[model samples]
Target: MKIRISWWWLPYGILMLASNMWKSALFLLLVLSLHESAHMMAAKAFHYEVPQVVLYPFGFGASILHLGHGSLWRETLILLAGPCVHLVVPFLLIVLVKFDLISITYANYLEQLNQSVLLFNLLPIYPLDGGRILLNFLHLFLPYCCGLWVNYALSVSLVLYLFHETAVLSFQIVLLFLLFQQLLSWLFIKREKEQFYYYRYLSAPKRIRLKHPFQDCFRAFYNVIRFEKEWMQEKAWIRRYFEKEDLKKRKQSHQIML
Candidate 1:
């Protein structure tokens, strides 16, 4: 996958250099890279197409093109992979220390960094791994649209609460950026939902069974629903939806011509 550096990284680097914390910044980047690499490896194992990986000042984020179209179980595993790296790395660091490959002081520093990164990433903010895991779990019970709304709402609330509790100016700025990102997502939620449905329409269907017809289709598996004691395939439902949309478009065009 292609690698990109975020524009914010430049200023962040400068700030770190000015503060004489460049070493810490570099170490954090290394840790973040390892974290993202775990995610990439897991995605590859599932044969998902990873388009690009972006490095932000805070951490690294990967763009997996078909991530949302896959089974929820696989998605959850991919999301957990990054955090699992943090959990495993501390033990690895201990091994290195025992072997005298690294000083205990340096190993301690890395361990602390790992913990900090893991904790920050676990915050229930949209687009974060923790937020996504929460969304995936929610999808098991709630309609896809309802789960999305709940995820966004929780993200906004948490960010607002962070703003009140945080005293660090730089961290506050980061929180503000996250808040802005969530607002943009909230504003374009309808468009996102449409794209989500379109993707589901194009992807291969799975034979998952559900008891009731959800407002939106499957988030984890492509479902066949037993609604009112009749079985309904998700593919057929989506096909009918597209047909209706096409008919509406044709009628609009015909009326405009008249």
Candidate 2:
């Protein structure tokens, strides 16, 4: 897959170096790399071809190619893998320190870095892991385009709020750059007719039932089936279908308890 660095990342890297935080910056980049690598591994495991990996100021973003060929659950898993790595690394670091393989101070620094990265990504802003996860969650109930609009709106609002609260010049500049990118996406989505059609198809049901089980498989199937009924006239049928499924599951669960 192709990799490209964001232009904003260049200025941020320079600032870090100028401030004599080059070592910290190097560690941060390595942490981000590990985060993105987790995502790449998940995508690859599912046979999804990642076309590009973009290195941002905070972390890397991977674009999986041929999204239509991939399952939504797989995509969600890929997004989640990044944060999971950050969450899991601290324990591993603790083990290393316990074994005297690494200094406690070094382990603590890495742990803090991982936590920072995790918190930044968990923010509910578009393009971040949290925002993507939120969007995926919304897609479970809302129409695909509606979910995109909501994600964009949340991203815009957060960007503005960050600009207001932020005092750091370098960070403000990065936020502005992110805002610009969001605006461009908004414009494209607004003006392009094909985008609507694409979302519809992208959000369309891939199969009546999942061929194989994966994480959150039932939830994913339910969402797909819900999305399929989104454009249908008879909304009652959709509700009834879900009610029946819920009842069936509850019955099976009760039987297991007995």
Candidate 3:
């Protein structure tokens, strides 16, 4: 997605628009950095590889790579990290501000920005934090399409709510744009589902159905191991039986010749 950093970040940039203030867009970048950094850290905890952090109209996300066989707990932790940091960082900064360690203006800015990031991310829609976390958990019970569509429904509702928000036009606009983007995203996912499943099925030798991308890979790997074990057991059984029969036949032939 050709997301322009300068365009969608107008609300964030307004914070640092004054002369000699270098924090304009950088503060938002810092927010994104915090979010994706947490995700990458959690991903690495499970030996998954994180390649890029994509910042969008809605929020920021990390594109994780080499996530071969992630478990529910692992994905959930990674999903939760963004909000956890958002919540904790502001609280810590407030503590510092109360102790006269940091300026009130700076502290307030951080606090609001953090809150904004958290609020924006926690929208219960797809491509958002609450939505994504919901999807990760939903994968335990339903297919990806089901979870994705649920998120999309929520996002559409969110867009409807935002469109009528009289106080926050920028936020409303951002929400609408995000809703469109994720709607497109959901469609793309639906189209690519068969292809992703096909590759996953082909990659592993065992006959396992592919649904969850990384988890399915693990299932396939386990199936391959099990198949190998069964093949070994059958081979051993056949060899033992055939050898025993051959020896008995030889003994009979020797007796007959005598």
Give Cα-based local distance difference scores for all models: 0.82, 0.69, 0.60
What range of 10 consecutive residues in model 1 has the weakest lDDT sum?
A: 204-213
Candidate 1 wrongly placed segments (more than 4 Å): 57-59, 95-103, 211-213, 224-232, 244-258
**Clash totals for all models, in order?**
0, 0, 0
Over the stretch 84-189, how does candidate 3's per-residue lDDT look in tens digits?
8777777778787889988889888878877877887887776777776766666555544565566677777777777776567767767777878886876686
The order of the candidates by TM-score, greatest first, is 1, 2, 3
Error of 2 at 246 (Å): 43
Give RMSD to native, each candidate. 3.3, 14.0, 15.4
Q: Which prediction has the highest lDDT against the true structure?
A: 1
Where does candidate 2 stray beyond 4 Å?
3-13, 54-60, 66-70, 95-103, 190-258
Clashing pairs in 1: none
lDDT of 1 by residue, 84-181 (tens): 98888888888989999889999998888789879988988988888888888888777778888999999999999999999999789888988999
Between 1 and 3, whose TM-score is larger?
Answer: 1
